[model samples]
Target: MPAPRPPTVPVLEVYSTFQGEGLRVGERQVFVRLARCDLRCAFCDTPESYPTPDNARVQRQPFGAKDEALPNPVALDVLLAAVERLDDPPGLHAAVSITGGEPLLHPHAVHALAVGARRLGLRVHVETGGHRPGAVAHVLEVVDEFSPDLKLASATGAPTPWDAHRETYHLLEGRRKALCVKAVVGAATPEAEVEAAAAFAVEHLPSAPLVLQPATPYGDGPAAPSASTLFRLHRAAGRAHPDVRVIPQVHRFLGLR
Candidate 1:
């Protein structure tokens, strides 16, 4: 009998870029953006993730519209191949950043990829929305870094599961891995939320960095969050969590992958 095959995992897109956020910001990394999201935040940066074949709750939107569905799913093998083909391959000491659509939603698959990457000596990092701690824990063994977002005032009015996020951060606190808490900034990200998120980070992951990203202008909309808002948030949040820093979506600024 043939050996049982590993389950195939669906990936949205893969590209190479300077890690635009989190503790490992500006590092050359292979970004694997997976293809689904549970939450529908009004200001969701990658609205393209909402309507996978799995997102039955999703309503299809136009290509450049608010919530566009991805037609192709890159399997795990194909994804790995693409990473190896990057321009600065091998010499870059690739850091595999498994982001979302909510990477924790596919923890088993993400963990598998991380394990495989580590075998090749690549560091692994994960960026999640902090919805499921149980799922997050399963990948901790292979994940070298954790960058969980503490969602604040989601555009859809969904509440942040602070308890779950806090629990997961604590799990990574003293571990050998580096950890960071990120909050995506928007016009609606209240000052109170910034203070609270910063305070929570300081109380929980005291040594970990906190990242603030100003929402970028994507799709037909009024505008992205202003620079003033980003500065204000960085200052206030930094007051509580001294390591807090502002990082915009560099891909947008540079107009590249």
Candidate 2:
């Protein structure tokens, strides 16, 4: 039998952009967008990542100064090399942001990458869906920051794993890891829903910052939440958790990828 094609390493879309949200807003950062996702949010901007059985249709996009997909069946050494290439000389940006369809999907790879980054004295941050507590713990062990999006009515047809997400949030509690819980506020984000998410975070991760973002105007029928609705949602979230803050996608504002 022909040698089976090597399993594609989880590729990262490495690019430079101002942080669109969270505690490090406006900071210059290298965004590493990992491929693949477990859930299909209706308003998923990167619908291409929705895990489908057919793999041939996966398209590769240009990344930063390099035009290569990440190491398929990636090894720690090869993945580290990609990180090194992202920086000129070394350490040009603020930190490495590990975002993806859901970085947790590839726990082993992410753990390897984070361990390597720490050895190089590079700061690491991870953005996730809060699905896998163990995966989140592994990434959090090496990362400086944890930005987990507590999915609040993601237009994607899949149901949110509230218990799992909540467990991850609590698991990170008491750790020095800076945690930020982000909720995508959309038309579906009712005041009660916002309060529930906020309350859960407040109860579990009281010290972690909570961020509320308006849904993007993308996807088949995406619509931006109104300013009035945002105000109410923001108020409700804040009432539940004093640390809540409203932030929009700043990268979109600056017109960077």
Candidate 3:
């Protein structure tokens, strides 16, 4: 029989950009943004990812010199190929960032994509909403780094899923692999919420670094929190977590997509 076809998932786009978030910020990475987010964060810049797309936009040449559209439910092979294309002179790129719509939702696809990335001598990073513990456990071994968002009601427009967050952290803690927690705070985000998120990180994954991402203005998303709010939130959260740092969406600053 011919070799089995690769698993497929709804891919939004595949492109290369500098790591724009916590921990590995500034590293060159090919981001595979999948479609279908579960949360409605008021400040989500990529609101387009909340729904499935008709096709996945792929960078067929370095620096996006050429682009192609692969029909939705794209195969794992195509994703790897896009990464390879963007890599240019080879090894110029770093890890393959497997991002939203909540990547953990498609655990099997995440594993397949991560494995393919490893074959190409690249690391695997999965960005999640930090609510799906079962899915996290399933793909934890394949993923090299976990960048999970701690969804706060004050920012994401949904009540905090404390139980799910705790359980997910319980699984990720103490692993040799990297872990970074992120909480998006808006201008009106209460200080108490930030403290709670920081304390939760300290209590569960004390070794994991936490990032306070100020919400950037997009549609219903609040504008960047005032400097006063940012300072107070960081100050309060920093008291509980040793590695807490405030990092806005750096890609925005660079005018990158």
What are the models' TM-scores? 0.82, 0.85, 0.95
Tens-place lDDT per residue, model 1, 1-257, is 99876466656666566777665767877777777888776557677766554421111211232433334544566556555655343747468788878888888889878987776678888888876789877888889887877777733357877898788877778684546777777776777788888998889778778878776655542245677777777878977888887877776666565
> Each model's C-alpha lDDT?
0.70, 0.72, 0.85
Candidate 3 per-residue C-alpha lDDT over 196-249 given as tens digits, one digit per residue, 9 for 90 to 100: 889998898777888998888889677679999999999889878888888888
| Reference-based lDDT, residue 254, model 3 | 96
TM-score-best of 1 and 3: 3
User: Candidate 1 regions off by >4 Å?
Assistant: 1-5, 53-75, 87-89, 154-156, 176-178, 219-223
Angstrom error at residue 30, model 2 = 2.1
Each prediction's total of clashing residue pairs, residues at least 3 apart in sequence or on different chains, is 0, 6, 1
Model 2 deviation from the true structure expressed as Cα RMSD, one decimal place: 4.0
Model 3 TM-score on a 0 to 1 scale = 0.95
Off by over 4 Å in 3: 1-5
**Root-mean-square deviation (CA) per prediction:** 6.1, 4.0, 1.7
**Model 2, residue 34: what's the lDDT?**
70
Ten-residue stretch with the least lDDT total in model 2: 53-62
Candidate 1 lDDT: 0.70
Question: If both were scored by lDDT, which would come out higher, candidate 1 or candidate 2?
Answer: 2
